[model samples]
Target: MGTVDRRSFLAWLSTGAVAAATLGRGGSLAVAEAERGATAGEVLVLRGATVFDGTGTGATADTTVVCASGRIVAVGRGLPGGLPAGARVVDCSGAFVIPGLWDAHTHSTEITPTVPALHLVHGVTGVREMRGSPATHEVRRRIERGTLAGPRMVVASNTLDGPDSRVPGATLIETDDDAREAANAARQEGADLLKVYSFLPRDQHTAIARHADRVGLPFAGHSPSLLPVHEVIRRGQRSVEHNYGMHLSTSVDAEDYFARLAALPDEPTDPNWWGRLAPLWEREAFRTYDRGRAGALAGLFAEHGAWHVPTLAVESAYARHPTRFLDDDQAQERARRWLPASLREQWRARVQAWPEWSPERAETELAYLDARLRLVADLAEDGAPVAAGTDCGSPYVFPGVAVHDELALLVRAGLSPARALRAATRDAARCAGIADAGTVVAGAHADLVVLDADPLADIGNSRAIRAVVTRGAYLGPTERQRLFDEIERAADGSEAPQPAGPAPASCCGPPPE
Candidate 1:
């Protein structure tokens, strides 16, 4: 596949307004706002906040974020100078405001209706859903029309899995012909990318990749069963959806975990987790040493330009903690109370399918889980581009809410706060093909969040959201109140207490220069 170099991509972008607009995957009414700059009549301004643009730009304080239509017209100082006479103003004086975030890797069978809560509650403006169904596009269309509130989705058609696997909702492939056919189908259906799952023959995987590239789509996902990790990456995989599948494929624990599951006479021959396996985690406990082999996967991924998406929280909540996540004070209520009913049913079934929910399961998986997390760190240190995604369909993955948890895990994996935030915003934007999101720069979309606290200080400061401005619509005191009223009219407990009050004027927290 011919890759778009960054400079040419930028040149193509600067050609015309329409060219830039075309790059935007319109979401809700915000697309219209993004096309037009913040003009006189109806602009939203966030004055005087520190910006953590996901581009590793560090933090710039005393800046103005001007929004009109829905896209940003100005960032940094001296902006909003021509704020069309009666524009709305949001004072973010003592706050940290940055681009809206993305949950880059997600897995779902059906388009659960409750994902809207994820968008509204978390500052998540977009998501890349790995496994999608017919209803998935329908849901996306509904959200695009503003009939429903949900994250802007970059959806792939479905897994082109190995022949015998019986992937739940994807278009299946058994032969190279099937892979090519599937590629055409995915391209024609407006699928942003094509995913090759485990079991696809190496030839089929390459065929799918060739077909996708020919059609201007990116091919990514699980490394096929027969192809070694390097071969898959060198073939131009845009991303690898999960972390462990490649490394653990030939390792001892893999055989024990998969082959020994049913015929297990004793615990497992692998001493991977050993005494520790019976403690912290559950089924995924054992992690044996295959340092030389595993390290190669990282190097190969880096050399081949593949990014890593670790859905650490999703796996942890569903496969490791078992019932504990449901009881987690910060997570379960949100999942149960807000997740759409249909998805909730799937969640119930998922939890039920786990191995006997015993304390031992957690023990078995703990060491491996920790090891996997260390794997994440190793990948990062090894220079692999890593991102955060919460596969919300898994048990206890409350949408929007869980990404904060995902970020926490990423930070735990040795990413600095700035880097972790970038993985969520800027890095994901680049990977998912979104333009200039995750930063506060002129000409970027005006998807902004004002935090009451500084995230770079402790990382958890991301939770201190004082206001949310999606597109050019500023969620100052009055608008938040209106949204709250609407939410309340729709249902009880829809309203979180509004922030104390608006900050000072002049967007930069002082008079405009």
Candidate 2:
């Protein structure tokens, strides 16, 4: 894995260069104050934009949204009364307003304020941190206390796995006692959820589930390899990340596949045994997929209220379309220019390490990707809740920007543009168990994105950000440009940041012994 110098990154952010760049010209003091949540009594109005409220309803035209004290006070066509005195109003004519997006799965806090700041720059106002540590906890605290300019964060405990854990630093749960202790520890540590991994023993997994239930902490992540998907769902996994076991579950030969998986050695000789094996399993599952079985599975998810976060962006980059960076010159250049040097080098090494695929193998992988996309469509059709997540911080998955890519992928997978938008906004918020967010309405957080074009017409238009309103601060074109400039400077190493520590393990990579 790559390493980042977080201390250096923080130093760069604190430097006068950044401050001067952001505040020197075209910067609003009110915008700066609002970002720090110091605009307690200030009112900001977004007028004349069409509002996509994220409630599955059609967009409302000519809407006016009033925000104060970091919350939306009113949203309507025209306030029955005139605007409040001393209110700062933005004329959003011809723009489309939508709820700020959420990256439902991220390890961004490992990089601290840099990743979080990028999320804000991309109009991602909230994130669910997939793995939490003392550092991440402190980052969240700072964001909430108005001392940091970042997104609202929902953090999960460090991953829990069985003996011979795939990830380094994961809490190993070999016995029921260990499971119970881990669950309680997560709750005591104030984790938003307890994250489980694929290698846990069945009994320990069950114990953790029950204990989390009793302790009122939601448990989520990969379905344990020792158990069937139905059993995992039955045990009340709040959300399944990456559609880990679904392809097998929906296969016509699922029982046989499960038997084969169960017979594999628990302690494999190869560290990435599962990673090497999963594609073969997925390809076979795709060929044998049963529509009836898939429909039933989707129905079960809906009935149980289990949410699915298909982080297709990372999956595509690393698994299904490993050659994307090699094939797309523009993409390669963008990644090289944007990623920190260490991270870029690490990702390049990983990509080069992939075995060269023959034409037939490449086609097979593409077909498997198609199958996954169809699976998402089937789930959406069957009323199974689907949320957009990019699995950012993984190899080749850029933070913040990938959320938009995931939305586009969802649309390509047969979801309407509006439904895709909801997956990133309302559905993502619900999946993360967050309240009073992900929608534009009275009493919700004043987090919004103003787009130059209608997102409902073209989900790609989401990238056409005219302005961003977060923490009751309106970051118009000028403020937004300043932010982009600062990020560029940091990315180019013009502002020297010192290396801090080892990079967190990639969510998709093989665990270190």
Candidate 3:
């Protein structure tokens, strides 16, 4: 993995310098977005229906939640009893309600040019952008002020990697001193966390980590090629990204940082096939990160209490998709319509493909992934404070609908639907260090959801959403339908965001008086 330094980070904070002069800016009026979201919070009522708190306490049916001013003032049976003469009301009709979903891992600013596409449409109430450029600073501003209609934004500013950091939009680094400076710069630029990239030298990673600790900014990203997976955690990186490093620690080489690093190059191609094959194909499997080892690492983190945001959703996408979801006609149409052509194009290109193991080498990839998954399951079971994340809707990953996909993958890994939901919801909140949201309880934020089906019965049912609430403003029936209508059009290949006026003003209807 590469280390970050302030100079590259500074350049990132000043994005136009690195980005191409666009063919032309797209439809986004980004300048107007942030100021728009600062509007007053509204009132919402999620009446009746079953409620899952994402707290593993089973659930309660026929509950009531009254929200206004961005906080819930009351929650119980028949809140506000009868509304005041002009107060709003919404009947749940016995659907299920739970905390809105979250994707701990995401590449946001580049997903779609329009603010509404991410905030209003996708079900993700919160997401962590694993990789971004300094341009993303605008993204944070817009979402915070409510100019954009997307989920709450938590960014790592830019992915930090080596001088040849494999990505066009990342902040590249090369030394420990550089890493420290970079961490400071990202922190000053308002980044929520330090997103480390894979393929860095072990010692440099350690140095960068020391910087992260000194600056009070938690570090989270890929494991280093040269370091043992447990060693990096022991050194105190807030979290491990995918199970990427887990395999590196157990690989044949004794920290083959440079050699193996090149093998796992950003792109899958290798000019020297024979040379690469010797080291890569001849690589040994990573069997496990037993409780003893994983626990020790977890213990170190618990002491400083770092977090782990597993982009588990990406694993499933790679396992089931061919880079982008474009292969699926339904998914493809959706991207072209709602997404900026540039971003949509990014998803389909092979160069942007996630790491893939050939179909002929299916078992090999599966075995490696299985080992990683097992360790994650054990971590969750052992209370490792994990968060659910996705690399979805970034190019080939579809937006507005991938959160459910992530939840199902978690269930398959042995999480009860409730536990899996928490990974996305409650645990994600903890990872981001935000506590005022993520639950539908009174005195909390009025961010909530109404599902037509029970997600606990089947994680996929999370998409059976009837209503959505951002802050205290609710997406009434008409508005929810409008969002889905846009989705249906995207899947079928039609126009992009239709001219739907402002979202509806009811969730279950308005809050009862």
Per-residue lDDT of 512 in model 2: 26
* Model 2: pairs clashing at backbone N, Cα or C within 3 Å: 5-499, 5-500, 8-497, 8-498, 166-511
Q: If ranked by lDDT, best first, what sequence of candidates would result?
A: 2, 1, 3
Tens-digit per-residue lDDT, 1-513, candidate 2: 112133432332233322333321122111222233233366787988888989878998887776777777566664333333566888888999999999899874555445667788899999998888877888888888977667889999988887856577788998878888888888888899999987777888888898888889999998876577888888899888886778888888888887876666665576445533543676678888888887888888888888889998876765554545766777676566555666666667766665666678777767877888999999899888998988887666888889998999999999999999999998898889987889987667899999999999999999999988887788889988887766665664532222222233334532222
Error of 1 at 496 (Å): 25
**Model 2 alpha-carbon drift over 4 Å, by segment:** 1-40, 80-82, 270-279, 319-329, 332-337, 492-513
What is the lDDT, from 0 to 100, of the residue 296 in candidate 1? Answer: 70
The lDDT of model 2 is 0.75
Q: Who is ahead in TM-score, 1 or 3?
A: 1
Give the TM-score ranking, best first: 2, 1, 3
Evaluated at residue 202, the lDDT of candidate 1 is 59
TM per candidate comes to 0.77, 0.86, 0.76
lDDT of 1 by residue, 142-219 (tens): 777777665668887677765544245456676778877888887777789887775565566877888888888888
Of the candidates shown, which would achieve the greatest TM-score relative to the real structure?
2
- Top candidate (lDDT): 2
User: TM-score of model 2 relative to the true fold?
Assistant: 0.86
State the lDDT of candidate 3 residue by residue for 437-480, as single tens digits: 67765445567778889988888888877778776667867886
